[model samples]
Target: MDPKPVNHAAWINSLGMSFAEVPVGTGSILVAREETQERHLALFRRSRNQPFSHAARPATQVSWTEAVAFCDWLTQRERAAGGLSFRQRYRLPSDHEWSCAAGIGHLESATRRPEEKSNRLPGHYPWGRAWPPPQDAGNLCGEESAGDFPDNFIAGYQDAWSGGEVHARASGPNPYGLYDLGGNVWEWCQDRYREDKDWRVLRGGSWKSARRETLLTSHRTHDPENYRSDSVGFRCVLAEE
Candidate 1:
């Protein structure tokens, strides 16, 4: 069997980004994209590293505000560097966008009960199921490769227990041809970090999480500004548009 390709530049270029693997600034790998330079603004709003760091709560090591700004920064960086259309735009992926990319739209459709708003997608867990039954398909955690556990897709959150920080790699990936998204770590979303000031919505559960609900694409958390946790981490998305 052939080996997987190692194309850091290609991967970064695809997302219109550039990465620097040092100083866990965002609580993970430090990435610089076109957004930081193009808009002539700051890449990460917070980007402040916390004093305390742990495998369970990575965010404490990364500032809550900086995580949100990274998306805007990445977008501008991509356009400036990749030569993409600035008018077209770049931004963080919303929960819906993430669901669409990870192939969990049907779950949203089913949750639109007859009593509730028509044509409204379910706002609960990613798949809308409290507990995914056996033999169903969910997605990856944080850093696990796809197809690692083909039958365990719907079984729930990737890490259900200890996270990937203690162990960098994990099993399998997802339908989107992405890896380790299921249970590696909790990823940051593009939303304003919260509906109000107290919290924001964090999607995709972490490896250390045991609850199947957290693994659901629709699952959310009351993430606050300047507050960081160990399980929290982030990935950037580039709109082909």
Candidate 2:
């Protein structure tokens, strides 16, 4: 058999995305630590490509519709290059799929139930069963955030991020090698905020979040598709043939 074709996840950084392959059945849940600013500018703004910069942080303050557009652009780009098969495409992960990739256990049913609001189990946070997150358990409202959204900051806990800003993948990865699933930014999932698809669901606490509990793997929130915030960002996933 021909040697396995190159894993695009390993080399797609040129597009300003660093993807971690989740251990799923046929397709892996490819999650970027945060949305790539460079990719957004290049794809949406029609900006010319530029060298990568550490300052190119997560593309925040973008709406859910914009995020979906990015996925479409990526899908078309890959297919046009013959890099993706007809059966493969990149898109946002379903709420359940996002939870599984974030180390949250399985849900009883395929769809959401009123009782299953959160994805995590009892007493489980992204950093495990700890109360206050450890030194670096992912970015969240902490010492640095007391000045701004002080109302939201969790008292008596410091994730050691005083800059009060979202960070990159250096914070470390989860069991699935996915980064920023607990913090850094609230990631958008494919599910609707409610039974109807009007609002969209967002998981993972963000840098400005004031509650530590928000970082729990089961913690979830919702926002209108057109709403944008400095604390919200997203990642994409692809199906593998």
Q: List per-prediction Cα lDDT, in the order shown.
A: 0.41, 0.67
Candidate 1 stretches greater than 4 Å from native: 1-60, 109-169, 192-197
Cα lDDT of model 2 by residue, 1-241, tens digit: 2112224344254365666666443445566545555444454545224333335667677678877887777787778888777787778888877776766535324466422666435667766677667666767777667776767776767776755466676256666566777777788877887776568889878777656456667887889998898878888887653
* Alpha-carbon TM-score of each model against the true structure: 0.52, 0.81
Name the runs in model 2 displaced over 4 angstroms: 1-14, 25-27, 33-35, 38-41, 47-55, 113-115, 160-164
**Candidate 2, overall lDDT?**
0.67
Q: Please report the candidate that would top lDDT against the real structure.
A: 2
Q: C-alpha displacement of 36 in model 1, angstroms?
A: 15
In model 1, what is the error at residue 136, expressed in angstroms? 14
lDDT of 1 by residue, 125-221 (tens): 4333345422222323322322443433433333332223422324333333343344445655555443445555555565454455555555555
lDDT of 1 at 204: 59
